[model samples]
Target: MKFNRTAKAHWKGGGKDGKGSLTTESGVLKESHYAFKTRFEDAVGTNPEELIGAAHAGCFTMQLSFFLVEEGFTAESLDTQARVYFEDGSIPKIELELKGKVPGMDESKFKELATKAKENCPVSKLLNADITLKTTFES
Candidate 1:
């Protein structure tokens, strides 16, 4: 099986003064506005790094859930935060913070599964950056 996702961006003007809109085929982001200020400065709207973080977080969390279910366990809830670092026009690293609870599961096993997810998630494999996973188990 194969799946393809698409997002398009349109820009007007130039550089810091330019304005842009981004849209995805799924329509979740329909003409979402973005600009240099939003990317570099603190302004409203989305940026590439933010979107990457969201994608990583979502993918890792779901992957963990799937692994747990396949192992005859279920997570009560899972939380993940992906922090992307962009430095000197390059993305050097991505850090994933994971927290979740699965009934009747040991912390060691949970951490092991989370590490596996980080290594195997599609986005993690696709990204050209160092990825690190830190997982915490909830009582």
Candidate 2:
């Protein structure tokens, strides 16, 4: 199977002073504002790092859900926070913090599955950075 997705960006002016808008094919981000201040300073706008974080979190969580189902378990809740560390003009690391509640599940199994998900998720595979997973399991 094959699929494709796209996002468009329009920028003008200098790097630090320029302003841009990002539009996604799904329309989830329809011409959303993005700028240097938004990325490096406190501003009311979205940035690429945050977008990557969101994608990583969503992909990892969904992958974990599939693994859980395959293991004959269902999660009552799963919360994931992906922290993308941007330094020296590059993303050096991505930390995925996950908390999950699954009835009749053990910590060992949860950790195993989460690790697998973190390694196998599409977003995880796409990025060239160190990825780490921290999981909290609740039964």
Off by over 4 Å in 2: none
**Prediction 2 global C-alpha lDDT:** 0.96
Whole-model Cα lDDT per candidate?
Answer: 0.93, 0.96
Question: Worst lDDT window (10 residues) for model 1?
Answer: 130-139
For residues 16-134, what per-residue lDDT tens digits would candidate 1 score against the true structure?
89999999999999999999999999999999999999999999899889999988999998999999999999999999999898999999989989999998888998899999988
RMSD of each: 0.8, 0.7
Q: Residues 1-139, candidate 2, lDDT per residue (tens digit)?
A: 7999999999999999999999999999999999999999999999999999999999999999999999999999999999999999999999999999989999999999999999999999999999999999887
lDDT of 1: 0.93
What's the TM-score of every candidate structure?
0.97, 0.98
